[model samples]
Target: MELQDHIMHGVFHSNGFGHLLCLNGLEAVAGSNLSGRQIMNFWDHLCNALRARKVSLNDISTKRGMELRLMHGIAYKAPWFGSWGYKFSRGSYGVIQPMYEKAIDTLRAMPLCILVHYLGSSNHDIPIIFSRYQMLSDHSLTTLGDMFQFMLELKTRMAEENLLDSYTGPGMFVEQSCRWSPKRIEMATRAIVEALKRADFRWVSRQEVRDAARIYIGDTGLLDFVLKSLGNHMVGNYLVRRCLNPVTKVLEYCLEDVSNIVPTQDPKVKTTIHQYRMSKSQLMKDMLYLYKHILKDYPSSLNVGILSVVPTAVRIILDAKYFAKEYHEDQHQARVEIGSEDKLSVYCTIMLRNNNINIEGTTTTLPPLLPPFECVRLRRSATFNELMVEVEKIFRDLYWGMKNLILDSVANLEANGKDLVFGQVEVGGKVIFQGSNKGGIGEEMMYYEGGSNWNKVVVCGCGAREDDGERMVSCDICEVWQHTKCVGIPHHQPTPQIFLCKRCENEIVTLPAFP
Candidate 1:
């Protein structure tokens, strides 16, 4: 509990999880003036001095506090990582440097026990606030503040990745009463009613808004929805954009009962109620589609631990713990408990491809692999082929399912006397829009995996002027327009569906029906 011990406590706590041991090892490796055993003994003393108080992840509810403690510990040993490798060495968090300097200056006299306790416990809120700032702040940093930039960037990246929730852990935002206060609940309800009015809707139809409020604020369903949406999105960016509306609604509803207003029974209110009902129905349908897509494509079976980076090729591994929820946890204790300690071991490994193949063939063929001359050996040739096949199968299933959903949505709009003129499909792979070119199916057009490419078809609007003698483009065997080279039809012989510079509008288009 001496002054030296107090400073050491702040220093150790700030250094993070295994800093004491890491430092000892580093000092020993460096052959510093202090011997390896002495370095280790000092670290041990520091750890023992701190272990007098036990803390767990649950003890820290805020990310900002957690980070402050981590930095406080790191400050005690400011010279440990040298200049470049320290993680929190820059940016808006340059605030860290002043704090570290203060800790160092004070450590010269502060008691070890008090300093350690303050950092290990009081500073726990650092991470919570720090993370929030990183997500929402845009403040520029001075030279001294440049060190904490990584903290800002890290927080931002994690939020975009939907990993923010995981980084902060559970119950950080959960209310102690297990429910919103009556005032909050009432306010939330009223907000829903007001939102409906702003949208030119009705308080009577506020039931849907109420339901949405319940899902978002009371039922914990909104978290799942937001997380699920993040599955196919860029996490941090997705979280920022996608969760904004839902979060706003939830906060409004829970903090301000805004959905229970009883407005005048105006004729416009009645009409707005009807429109609201229809829109609510459509929203439900869209949500169902999203839910199904998540269930089918990102099954619990596929939810394995994530590996952020790897320089060398390696096989992928999956642990059931990553994907599967605790069955007992989900069902609300409905299932019977078995023996006290019979934990099942469930783990699996999957092969991911690390190969590239070139597709080559005579002008008329669609060869699976690149031509022999162009083929290059891969690290895992067999595994790559298998992975390719699996990816293809997944793509096919996704394509068909999403295509149907798109068409069905369009059909539903048409049935409801609405326009489907400018809608898009929610597919994740190659787009299979009907097209005409010499190639069967014509051009294979699609946006690349990362939306990096914009491969789409463009055509002149109706009633455009053109050369009458120009070779007319038509599907070789169908009533569809196609470029001559797209259909694989020999230019010399114009097939029945093929046109030669001129054709009648009444010509019967024929070909196999689309799949």
Candidate 2:
């Protein structure tokens, strides 16, 4: 073959999957076609022939000498040429050859590219050496060491050039994988506590808490991270009471007095206590209690979706009934009764009063009210299992009509009685009814349709969702469900006959076993 044709063939052979097999020779030995073995043997024989003619292996492996013999041509300029060289020279040396010196040169030129791609404009260096150098295909410790050395030199050069601030120190290559920092948690807790206090212990919006925390933690992203990490534990620790605001439809936080909070191991008791704080009325409190009882007896009755809308549904019904009575003297009385079989029945009559008045020389005439003049009488009877379902349906049906009627009644009450507030109905400065329509019954109905899983009572120290199919172990002492892995039980091991969580085990003293 002509020299040009031989060079072309060499380029094709060196750049093909055959070259990949050589690069991954250790791994490919068991998998690749043995045809490569014949080619390598031929190269070995040719090298030995040159050695017999008194040509040294060093002279054969030199860059110009290898270029002449291997006929790599321009393919040697490629990024992986060093690896190819290592493969080609491996038959002669039987060790990692000088080709790695060139590979180190290529790696030295890669620090700026790696740093720019990984770190970008952020001064917060990602504290992982492997992550910083993940762009490189070769991840051996030797290659990593060279990469790290180059990156350090680059940092020093940038600093000396005044490209970086004098105060900026060396990038700590330690792994910082923790979700929350101590300083962040402390700052976030202080900010939230202050926000709750500013709201006079009333429910404060999440935005308010974030705004308060932003002063301490400047980065918006970091602030959110801290809040999310701490929010769940805050509720469990009784540091804050979190609830979805009925008016704003946003999550709100209220400070809890740790002294007044009762710690309980029962998940049911913990859930009830949380709900009790959220309940606005005695009826709501009772309904929640009864629902919990029913859920205990019939596990299938537990529907977190339905229960989430209960507060808004009850508020709507009460406000509609109250407005009906206030606007019309002859309004039908609203009645709520608990049956002997633990069923609840609600009867509410919503009336739209005629407001268009005409005066004719001492004779007054009022026009008939709008198209929905006829009163909407809503009545629902449901057992504990059906309570939330029935309430949700009634809310969807009566929301729009009752909302307008309630607003009109409030306006009239304010005009005549001069006692109504915009957001609340108060008597003797005590809020009787929260009358805000910011997130009214319509919004609540929409939220129900949107499939919100708010107020779901999750189990385990890890707070794994109830639907997640993790293997769980019920503590013999507390009876709370916990993931087997969380409680230190291996997946292959059979559950112990008696298992107690650390909390429960700490609470009860165990007698020492007799020898």
Candidate 3:
């Protein structure tokens, strides 16, 4: 019930998550007692035509001709449709039936499994059915029991609180904002986070942080929203210090070769895969290089740009303290032109300021990039399902690409007469391919490791991901490992140095207490 509550009432756009899960639960309830057709006002018969929209059995739709074709949306990621505000949109809903039918064929969504589907392409970790353990991006369980136990405890709390109604679950009935404005987003965020804290929910906060993001783009340039929304705001000053190394390490590893990405049949396929991997590899490296050489000193420097699909063009600026300001364009301007893809865009310049995102002291103005450089591109879409399709396309291309790059990088360096090549990894440590000077790449994906909870996502939160998690140092104080990238420190830091995380730095005393 608690899981249902969480699924149903997400801040930005999560109805699809709840709607689908409720359909599953309703199916079981309907199955148990053939005569029990109604639970509260949610009638079992209502599911007659709607049931096709609700249940998981591949054949459930056989009772009716209607089928669901859903996918994950990038903003407020839920299994959404083609256009903005799709759930309430008839235009958007029309497109989903065909699209969702193609994507939601995973095992948990199969048959009648009651797995907690998180909905959409979870940036950090995805929900796994019949398994509690979260398989890392490379597909390994990073933690055990937390995601599953969180559910058990949530159900217990709902029962104890006497708040568990057939119709009303946790946030199952809360109304989310029409758009994620900074104020509206922050309010929804505070409510969910506070509620989860009271329930003693161990994880899922980071996932919430991402889902309720306030930054946005309309037909106007520079979405007038909060910086916390534009960036990984969950990373406090302490985490920016601790996690920067891991971010660098991961980027470095991404440069190296990986192994065990699923293989294919032909040689030409292999070569194409190599180009994709190298292109991505080169992109990541170039991003890092630009941040260090140019953006590091000049925040207002117009030298930066990014390549992505968005209706409006905007720029963003961030300082250590999360200082933010916005510029705007005409409000009534039309969103889509004669031809363009439906998507959101966020941009910020690389500026370093202590309490100052604007440099006032001594500084040198670097020349603007001749071609207008871009660091990294952030993609946005109306639904995670569309994002998933694009992401799947990338992964399909990158799957063999990631694997081939790993192998080729190793082979190339070995042939070049390097002292060291590929490093063997220990069970729960960093996966590195070593060299005389920080060489070789390791596979980002690992296989799944089952945990105590057999029916939940392995882990929760954006921070719990294995790709970024291994290099991060946990704060003895707050305990959350921290989000990716840097704010308080340099992108690359010298290792073996004793450091205090920002929570400790600010003298944080204890963790939040349950109500």
Candidate 4:
């Protein structure tokens, strides 16, 4: 590629996915610029250009070489950049001005045009190495809490750079899909580990270190955002301080990995568990509890994508060191919790308000969700009530949304071979399952569907083997069942062949105790 094309490539790459990956150490070593192969070519071009000046160099991989690249915002306005640096401006990066002017002046005298041109062409972002968190000037990663602080600070910088709220698409939180590339992950991982080596945990206890690592490993992005961004949580000061307290702990639940619970193990072996539940219900509870309390005083935070953000946060807690392999039977729970949030967060958020009759500020008793086409007369200081309407509307949409999933799932099943049986009983003044299956295999709904997507959901409550066969049976009529074993039948008793769910069984003879 021509020099300009080369530069533009570097520039465009850095400003896009390059920068994000750089944040996570996912992109090339220096902000999103060139790959190793491309870097070598660019290096050679610079070396050849500077050869006559006797500034011989092997490559730009050296520490000094990088400083030149990182400082390109100032360094590149030098000789033989051939006015290209001034004449053309594209996506760009900036380095803070240094204390010494003469040092830069001396660099300007060198025939470093090729180097300058390369950096100017690619608007590469550099990884932020020097930050306030480095303990006592030890050039290393700080404590986990401090690491969060640094990330939050970096987020502010990203916002300033116009990277943070720039939309990529619907439901996409960040540009480049908010996923770091493999190479960038490796780079970030190495950097973090190496920096972590510099940390001194002498003042900290083992449990603290473990919890810190747990939170980070589970949901690094969410933890960082919550800690650094949300200052003074609802009625509580700085969310991190509130959550970090084990005494005032919020998201706590003992998760039992009951998926593999055999009748034999249920009697003999002692079961181990983690505080975070793998079940979707528990995940929803944890999330709702946290957001409800923390965002109460700052409800505007709820105005953001609660669905996307809540589950992400919950996943981090689940993935933490607290819940290792012992707590996860098939790792399917992880996928379910992450995926189901779009359906869950809507109703879950509104369900919490069922107890509070009035908005703290207004006399208006909360009303049902307003229709999108419907308008309500606004009163002064009715912000709290308006927020209530939004919550209600979201709950209405989501509650029905959960109902629709069963319909879609049943519709697809009927076309293929079956349908879901709607349970007659409602729980806690609300319909728990849209389809009637009082006692299913697990508490999990049998399937999920939207448009072209549909699949059976294996319930963990039923103690069916992991995608393996203990032989799950569905109702032949409506085909809305999965029973590997009877809920109360003795193991010594012979298992039946043709069977139906209680709702389905009602069509036939007397119903056996529902599984």
What's the true lDDT of residue 182 in model 4? 30
Kindly list the per-residue Cα lDDT of model 4 for residues 404-442, writing each as its tens digit: 222111111122212111121111111111122122222
Q: Write the per-residue lDDT of candidate 3 for residues 1-515, one digit (tens) a residue.
A: 45532212212111111132232333334334331113312432333323112221111110011112111221112221212122311111112222323222221122111111211122111221212111101122112123222232333343322432110111111123424433344344334333333433333333333333322222122122222222211211100000112433421100001111111125443222111111323322333332232223322422223211111111111110011111111211122111234333221111111211112353322221111111111233222223223333332342331222111122112222222111221111111121111111222211112211111221213213322112344444454443223323344753324544665766644756669
- Estimate, for each residue in 211-319, the C-alpha lDDT of model 2 and write its tens digit: 9877766777766654553332333224454566787798776654432222233554322212111112322233233223321122333323433333332222111
Which stretches in model 3 have alpha-carbon errors above 4 Å? 1-470, 495-497, 508-515
Q: Arrange candidates by lDDT, highest first: which order?
A: 2, 4, 1, 3
Candidate 1 residue-wise lDDT, 1-515, digit = tens: 23322212223332122232122232223434553335545654554544312111111111211222222222333322222123223211112344444433332223322222222233333222222323233231111122133342343344232422211111012223434443343344333434333443222222445455453356444433322222111111111111223433532111111112111134443222110111323323332332232212223332323211110001010000011101112122122122224311111111112212223441332211110011111122123233223333433343321121111111112222132111221111111211111222222222122121122221212211321122335433343443343334576967554343223333334434679
Global lDDT of each candidate: 0.26, 0.34, 0.23, 0.26
RMSD of each: 32.5, 37.5, 34.4, 31.3
Q: How many backbone clashes are present in model 3?
A: 28
Top model by lDDT, which number? 2
Clashes of 4: 20
Stretches of candidate 2 off by over 4 Å are 1-176, 235-237, 262-515
TM-score of 4: 0.15
